[model samples]
Target: MPALDNDTVSKYLERYAEPESTFGARLRRHTDHILVIPAQDEAATLLEGIYPALNAVSVRGERTLCIVVVNATDEARTIVHTNNDHLLQTLTALGPTTPLHTQDETPCWYAEAKGFDLVLVDRNSLGCRLPRGQGVGLARKIGCDIALASLRSGSSRAQLIHMSDCDVQLPSDYFDITVPMSSAAVIYRFHHEPCGNHAIDEAHARYEAYLRYYVLGLRHAGSPYAFHTIGSCIATIPTAYAGVRGVPKRQAGEDFYLLNKLAKLGRIHTARSSPITIRARSSLRVPFGTGRATHDIARNIDAYRIYAPRIFDLLKAWVAALGALDDALPARAYGAVYERASETLDPLDLDRLSQALLTIDAPKALSEAAAHSSLARVRRKWAHDWFDGFRTLKLVHALRDTGLVDIPWQLAITESSFCRSSPTDTGTALIRDRDAFETCRRLARLEERP
Candidate 1:
């Protein structure tokens, strides 16, 4: 594993680490990579689908440890608890197990597996169930925290804490990519596999297209924080993970927030190898994500709409203007920057841009950025950092809410230069054209070059 600061790792684990489980010195050593999967009510899927897929992963000569955190909230349904019990039991029966650690009534065990060592963390038992609001965020934190602690304890040589869900099939080359030591994290390319159900497949196509379209939009706007924030598609560096104070304990949007913070630390490299095959299925496991998106879209495909392309256009102007802020006079930096940004927009778009900027308080923010640093380059960096991923998303929403209402997904796809280089069919016909929409999704991925 790449070298990490012992101090940072120790500090983070000491203060921000999860309290449920502990990784003692007896934990297996010489691990080359660690993959963390948070499984909740996924017994059959874990045993039949995910397990076989993991065994097929080809990481030669490397001792990989797969840490699966079997978790459920105290308020979870009886079926969830039953599934958790079955999963834990089946895993225990797989091979002879060695006790690792137990704290707060949470039991962690280690067992030899086909292609990787297994560390099964039980957070779903009667006394150890997670609290209602903690959800997957805490589960992920528990698993990743264990991975971090294990790596810090000199038992594991892995630098990256690979994260995925029970619903995805990892690529065989998942652990084979070589990332620069300077990289804060790397996001694996992912494609949601069709379940052969017509309605679900159609919904998956639109939802995946929407995801790609948004990322492509950000890339076109010259945003550095344009990567997808799916927890299943990310692998974070040890030091960078600790630097961000570990993952947030949010019930939803945790992945988005985690990546948003990680992006500020260093480059989030995009892996160009085989894409992870994610199973497209409906679920209400969390508030929102691929599952929820597909579920809703399948029910009301026509009602689903994407942001207007004009919003991205305005965003592009704003990003460009922020980049040019360094050239402005210090005395009237905010005014000069705003004027330059406004000059790029047409008269009708100017008001919308001005209103959106006002909503986000861009003028005061830019002034403060200038006040923070006198050097042109430093001030420019400050501006960009200040307008990070979360704020960029907020800006998009502000523009949408102020005046640029969302257009139909069909119109957005056909009109967005970021999504398509040429115009496509119009109206309801395009919406029903799954092949055409899938083609657009592929194009969007190409345009989102790493």
Candidate 2:
């Protein structure tokens, strides 16, 4: 059962949901699970690749509701609009569709597919297009909001709202995996599939390697919010989704922000089920992410770099010191925190850490947090909340700006203590040969460890 009351969920949907799309009588039918996929100019992949993958999912005695939000901004190019129109036409021709309701002159349709109930949301039509600057984030919110409404109304047995993209092939056990009710969200393990294009495949390898490296760095640094935030690999509990006020309506980075908030609410479970295989293809979608990284890396792989290992060393020291704060300390206890942090660093690195901390105003922030709460646990919670994932990334950038600059991916991997201890060799040969795909495989193995 959902943790939120019907009135509360209804209010959230009314305010943040896509208008009039979840009220159809046909949508009240029972479903065991719900999966939302946001699509733009992805008709061919969604129809040919994703649809078959969803059908192959092994969900015995369970009905899955798959909502695909076909969206485009008003400023989208002609090619995008044409593709969306074609996608809608093709889907409508699949089988008879029950016309749900129209929002902003766009129609929503429901069709029963082989393994799932398909809800095709049309946000690409003339007056129904998404607003300028709102891209995948808005499209995702529309689909998820409807899913949440169904769950709240007892139309679905699931308390988890699954999110994915048309570019990925979900595993056979994707819907069968079990998640604890206490969890705020679950992030499925994923790997990028090698496309026929060598350049694109190599670029994806490097990008995926960089992502795993960053997360491993965070884990070594003792950060609680150390999970992957890929939008396509996440499933949020209904309560946590509502608690965070739903997904942000940004053009990009929605996954990062959503998981960041969800982490504070409860544990984020990482699934060990068969991994989702994402297609390795370059795209100009939205602003930045796997697509942008792939495009940039294929152009100049040498220019792509990861954060310096020294940066994570500094982060590790800071996090350790923060965790050591005591309630017995004075109201302005940042001095002790800084002292503990400095003890972990060499003299030269201490100066760099000091400068980076000063740049982020860590002293003042820690002082304020201590002053606000005398209870040790409360003070620590306040500090952690203040230094959330966004601030952590900002601190990393601040360290880069202060002194410790980003190094080549190969050098960072070899120099990182976290990678050095891995079963695979962290050698200079990685730099000499520039085997990015091999490096990616090594990092993926490291990430798969218990």
Give the CA lDDT, 0 to 100, for residue 141 in model 2.
85
How would you encode candidate 2's per-residue C-alpha lDDT over 66-179 as one tens digit per residue?
888899988889999999999988877666688787544458888876667888888999888898888999888888887888887778877689999888888777776777
lDDT of 1 by residue, 152-269 (tens): 8888888689998887877667777888877899998887777888888878878887888888889889998888999999999899999998888887788999999888888889
Native-to-model Cα distance after best TM-score fit, residue 357 in candidate 2, in Å: 1.9
What TM-score does prediction 2 earn? 0.93
Stretches off by above 4 angstroms in model 2 are 1-8, 20-26, 51-53, 56-59, 102-105, 328-331, 421-434
Report the poorest 10 consecutive residues by lDDT, candidate 1. 421-430
Where model 1 places Cα greater than 4 Å from the true spot, the runs are 47-59, 102-104, 327-331, 422-437, 448-450
Model 2's C-alpha root-mean-square deviation from the true structure amounts to 2.4
